[model samples]
Target: MECLLGLLKVKVVRGLNLAICDPLSHSSDPYVVIHLGQQKVKSSIKYKTINPEWNEELTLSITNMMLPVKIDVFDHDTFTKDDSMGDAEFCILDFVEVAKKDLNGLPDGTVMKTLHPDKDNCLAAESHIKWKDGKVTQDIFLKLRNTETGELVLHLEWVSIPGITH
Candidate 1:
């Protein structure tokens, strides 16, 4: 956790660093984005491989709203000759809430909605909120359709908070 000076009060970042490499193929670099409400916060992770893999750890600031933090990863396709070929994976990790003693289990889960593909345009797949054990923090996977190809693609897994929950 780190502290920063804000306008009025101090802002605390109690977030986890996520390292996502080439999930599907080792050739392309992974593109990552953090969605805070309707605004999309661009992360440092981009579509480029340094060593054997590409990695980036993003810090998500905790807020008071019951907002679902979404992480969208797209394959670096611009480098390739073909611009149309790429895979975009979307994931809503968890809600940002103050670290409280009573909030062991995540009261609300993420909901998926179908959308058109384009920078924060539309979500291809949708799901409803389902409460589960707090201790069980695993990647929630979802399948979405690529608007161009209309093929079902596997999106990124949403990681849940570990210590705060049961």
Candidate 2:
């Protein structure tokens, strides 16, 4: 295991047009799982909604800043194994680069960086990393890949350990 450099705080805000894993009920009990390297963390399950509003915060100990953080949505089950809704991954390196910038004089909503959708990512639309609420954050609408349809709304923030410089 590598030395922990910081904690990547992820807010799984909500889902949009998520896959209906429960066929009989025509809905899904959705939850999110986040991964960095071999470490994984899961959010609380939001029951019976295709557009579930999680608004849950989960954190992962990040050692390497270059690795992409992976996100997967699953439908919880009672008797059987949980079914996968879809998956997406975001590059922390991108966010970290912008976070290192001096935003002290910038306005609250000033756009720092604009990232467009690409084959390498699941971004549903253009993403902007900016300073909000005295923190550096990026809100993303990730278009889940490898299934019919789904989108996830996420807020990502990087918090470095105090007195530790990477």
Candidate 3:
């Protein structure tokens, strides 16, 4: 008899969707979190799945400046203690700089220009950056919203690390 080895590799990027297969069929109540320095971060989309014999694909929204992202998946079964597993070391993605440009439409237009853009939206739009020879340069877009007024306030701009294109 011969032996077969399988390896799993996952890449965590901004404004991108990722999938993780359920390692066990017993239960699927996995959650992921990110860590930067001593800070712990949570995902924007949180859900539970009852699907068995399959994996879960999740779309991640660009969060605030959190680096050295650490992913952990936890499984809670009905009969056993919660099983914590799945950890991956994400590359150190940092917020290099930020800028802003005027919205592309006229002031009196009906479709209304970006009321306000924030750093997060910038990262989402420029998801595919240029990475060559371990160097990267790119811009992200963000639309800022006012919590009290419920209006678009400003536009956000951001750049990624040299090696992290887009």
List ranges where model 1 is wrong by over 4 Å. 1-27, 38-55, 77-99, 102-139, 142-166
RMSD of every prediction: 11.0, 1.5, 17.1
Instruction: Give the clashing residue pairs of candidate 1, or none.
Output: 112-126, 112-127, 114-123, 115-122, 115-123, 116-122, 135-166
- Reference-based TM-score of each model: 0.33, 0.92, 0.32
lDDT of 3 by residue, 53-138 (tens): 22222222233333443454444455786554344433224322211222334233222122223343322233333232222322
Per-residue lDDT over 1-166 for candidate 1, one digit per residue giving the tens place of the 0 to 100 score: 4232111111112112222333464443444445654446543433434221223333444432344544454444545532222233333333211222233445554232223335552334343323234321222222222323212222222234444342
Clashes of each: 7, 0, 22
- Candidate 2 contains a number of clashing pairs equal to 0
Stretches of candidate 3 exceeding 4 Å from the true structure: 1-26, 43-67, 77-81, 94-127, 130-166
Compared with the true structure, what per-residue lDDT tens digits does model 2 show for residues 1-166? 5877777789999999999988899999999999998899999998989999988889888778889888888999999999999999988887877766667777888778889999988889999988887778889999998779999999888786777754
Model 1 quality (TM-score): 0.33
Q: Please list the residue runs of candidate 2 whose C-alpha ends up more than 4 Å from where it truly belongs after superposition.
A: 1-3
Which of the numbered candidates is closest to the native, going by highest TM-score?
A: 2
Q: Between prediction 2 and prediction 3, which has the larger TM-score?
A: 2
Model 3 gets an lDDT of 0.31
Give the candidate order by descending TM-score. 2, 1, 3
**Residue clash pairs of candidate 2:** none
Best lDDT among the predictions, by candidate number: 2
